[model samples]
Target: MLSVVIPLYNEARTIVRVLEAVQEAPLPTGIGREVVVVDDGSADGSADVVAAYAASNPALGVRLLRHAHNQGKGAALHTGIAAASGDYIVVQDADLEYDPTDYAKLLQPVLKANADVVYGSRFIGGEPHRILFFWHSIGNKLLTFLSNAFNDLNLTDMETGAKLFRRELLQGLMLREKRFGFEPEVTAKMARIPGVRVYEVGVSYYGRTYAEGKKINWRDGLWALWCIVRYGLFS
Candidate 1:
C-alpha cells in the first residue's frame, strides 16, 4: 500500500479539493491507498472540513490527526509519518500547488525501477506550470544546486513537495527540521543512506501566488540554506 501523508496548515479553501483529488487519483493496480492527514492547528476550519469529508466517505482509509497549536510543516509531517502503516510513503502538501494525479507517475520508479526514493521534479517535463515568481524559481534552483554540491545528487527540484520513500527508510531517519527546512534536511540525510536508489521524475506544477495563499517566504529560503549547510556538510 502507498501511504499519502498530507501536512496542512491554514488551507481551508483548498483542503477539500485536494483531498477529493487524492481520493480520485489512480494508483497502479495492487497498490492500495491510505491517507494520513495532519492538521497543524489550522484556524480556518481545515480540520473540520477533513472530518466531514472522512465521515462522508466512510470507506476511504482516511486518518485525521491534529496538533493543538500550529507547528511547522515538518512537525505535522512527522505526526503523519509516525501514524502511517503503508509500505511506502509520500508527502502531499494540502495546498493546490501540487497535483494529486501525479502520484502514480512519481511512484513508478519505486514500483518498477527499484527506487527506494523518488522525487517529482517540477523543473523538468513539458507539463503545464503556472508562470509566476521568478525570484522564487531562482531561489529553488540555487538551493537545489547547493544541496546537490553537498549531497552529490543531481536532483532538479530539491524543494519539491512530492517526495516518495520506503516507509522504513523515512521513519528511521532523525528528521529535526519543523518547517520549510524539511526539504534540505531530508535530502541531505537520504543521500547518506548506503545503496539507496533515488530517482527523479518530471511532474506538473500549479504554483500559487502570495495573494492566492502561498505561505513560503524569503525567511524559509534562508532556513533551507542553513539546513543544507548544517545537515549536508556536517553529516
Candidate 2:
C-alpha cells in the first residue's frame, strides 16, 4: 500500500479537490493507496471538508487526523506518518500545486531498482510546468545547490514536495523539523544514511502565486538555508 500523508492547514477551498484527485490518481499495478490526512487545526473548516469527503468515499480509505491547533506542516506530517500503515509513504499537500498522477513516476525507481527514497524533481523532465515566479525559482535552485554542497548530493530539487520513501526507512528516522524547514532537514538527514539508495525523477509543478494562496515566502527560504546548514553540517 502507498500511504499518502497530506498535512493540511487552512486550505478548505482546495482540500476537497485535492482529495478527489488523490482518489482518482493512478498507481502501480497491484498497489493499494490509503490517504492519511492530518489536519493542522484549520480554522477554515478544512477538516470538516475532509471528513465529509471521507464519509462519502469510503472506498478511498481516507483516514483523517487532527492536531487540535495549527502545529505546522512538519508536525502534521509527523502525526500522519506515525499512523500510516503502508509499505511506501509519500507526502501530498492540500493545495493543487502538485499532480497526484506523478505517483506512478515516483514509484518506478522503487519497483525497478529497489530505491529506498525517490524525490520528484520539477526541473529535469519534459513534463508540463506552470510558469510563475522567477525569483522563487532562483531561490529554490540556490537552496538546492547549497544543500547539495553540504550533503554531497546532486539533487535538482531538494525542496520538492513529491518524495517517496519506504515506510520502515522513513519511520526509523528522527525528523525534528516542525515547519517549512522540513524539506532541507529531511534531505540532509536522508543523505547521511549509509547505503541508502536515493533517486530523483522529474515531476510537473503548478506553482501558485501569493494572490493564488501560495504560502511560502523569502523568510521560509532563509529558514531553509539555515536548516540545510544545521542538519547537513551539524547533525
- Model 2, span 129-208: residue lDDT tens: 89998999899999999999999999999999999999998888899989999899888888888999999999998988
List model 1 lDDT by residue over 36-154, tens digit each. 99999999999999999999998996899999999899999999989999999999899978898999898898878789999999988877788998899999999999999999999
| Count of steric clashes across candidates, in order | 0, 0
What's the lDDT of the predicted structure labeled candidate 2?
0.92
Worst 10 residues of 1 by lDDT: 121-130
The superposed Cα distance between candidate 1 and the true structure at residue 80, in angstroms, equals 0.8
Q: Can you give the TM-score per candidate against the true fold?
A: 0.98, 0.98
Whole-model lDDT, model 1: 0.93
TM-score of 1: 0.98
